[model samples]
Target: MTWTLVTIPASHYCDKARWALDRAGLAYIEDGHMPILHWRAARRHKGTRTVPILVHDQGIAADSTDILHVIDAHVAADQQLFPAEPALRARVAAWEERFDRQLGPAARRLVYFHLLQDPALTTDVVGSGAPRHERVIFRGLFPLLAGLMRRGMNITPAKSAQSREKLQALFADVGAELADGRRYLCGDRFTAADLTFAALASPVLLPDGHPVIRTAWARVPPAMQAEITAFRETPAGEFALRLYREERRASGL
Candidate 1:
């Protein structure tokens, strides 16, 4: 059966799944949707309200990580997300978990906190891969959608501040790990952890050729732009950008 990846298009988690599938050379169709509209599609496919869900003839992979595991199972060993060595694979999994639990949410909160303030840019970001009618609908319902997203994602002043701090700390940790001059997060080779970090960090880095069309850096709030500039200069952030420029496009997807 052909694989269909249901996604919000600009979602970092969805990017992770996309990267994994592409890296594994798996052919799949992307069924993209706008924000809240994706919940219905996700539920129809996998009985879940979140996206990055993969559906195939065999069954459904309801999460990005699950999709990566599915790809790993189908692909050759060398193309697997996890390393062959057990210990290294464990480290990769642990790092992937850390980034998924912390970096991903923190990045989302930070980005949404700012984007929610500007309806036009928010629409642009969310409507990138959606149909024209859906884009118009999103613009029309943006106020309601923004409110729901803020509440559901807990994007308050306090949480946004906390998310910034968390993101800085995590970036510092990643920089420290790379300080020893290691090529990848877990080892010399690319692994799931590196992909997770690069994909999740895309919101902040706004690497060129990203699936999403981000607000211009010049138009960002001064304070946020400063933070973004600093992060982009960091070793870890550079690593993520390099991964996107080198690995992400190489798949030719």
Candidate 2:
């Protein structure tokens, strides 16, 4: 039976789940939705209000982390997202959790703070990949939806500034981990840690290889574009971009 992935077309967390599933060679149809609209979809699947809920023959995998575990159980050991070794697996989990807790929300808030300033751009970015009717409805109701999103996410200027600081700190942490000249976050092999960070950071960096969420550079506001450029120059940023270039694929092999 084919799996169905519930997703917000522009959500980085959804991208993380998509990346893992693709790498595992799983074929699934994605049911894409807009921001507030995704809650209804999630509820229909008996999942918490979040995108990237994977509905398979066996069961429902709620959230990106759960989706990864489901994929890991199905794939070969070598192709798993988590390391087979205990210590290494713990380290990967720690890193993945940190990025999830810290990077994902912060990056999302910061970008939304900027993107919401222009209703049209916001519609194009977040409303993408949904059905045409949804897109049209979203565009018409963007003012209301954007307000709801800002309030739900608490995307104030102060919070956006705080998120910027958090992003810098997390980037520095990644850079320190890579200072030893290791190819990937956990040595030569790419793991969930790397995937999580890269996918979560995609909104700020907009790396070339992303499947969705590729808003044109010209369309971005000047201030936001400057920040993206600065982020792209960092060691951590470089690392994430490289992973997108070389390893954001359907299989590690």
Best by lDDT: 2
Candidate 2 global TM-score = 0.96
List model 1 lDDT by residue over 1-253, tens digit each: 7889898888899889988888787888888898997888888887889989999768999988888888889887876879889999999999999999999999999988888888887777777777777788888998998899999999999999999999999999999999988888887778899999999988888877565644456666776677788889999999998888877843323
Per-model CA lDDT versus the true structure: 0.85, 0.88
Model 2 C-alpha RMSD to native = 2.2
TM-scores of the candidates in the order shown: 0.95, 0.96
* Whole-structure CA lDDT of model 2: 0.88
> In model 2, which residue pairs have backbone atoms overlapping below 3 Å?
none
Give candidate 1's whole-model lDDT. Answer: 0.85
Please give the distance, in angstroms, between residue 49's alpha carbon in candidate 2 and its true position after superposition.
1.0
Give per-residue CA lDDT, model 2, range 1-253, as digits (tens).
Answer: 9999999968999999988887778889889998887888999997589888999989998879988999899988887889899999999999999999999999999999999999888878787788787878888988898889899999999999999999999999999989999988884698999999999999999887777766556688999999999999999999999988888774211
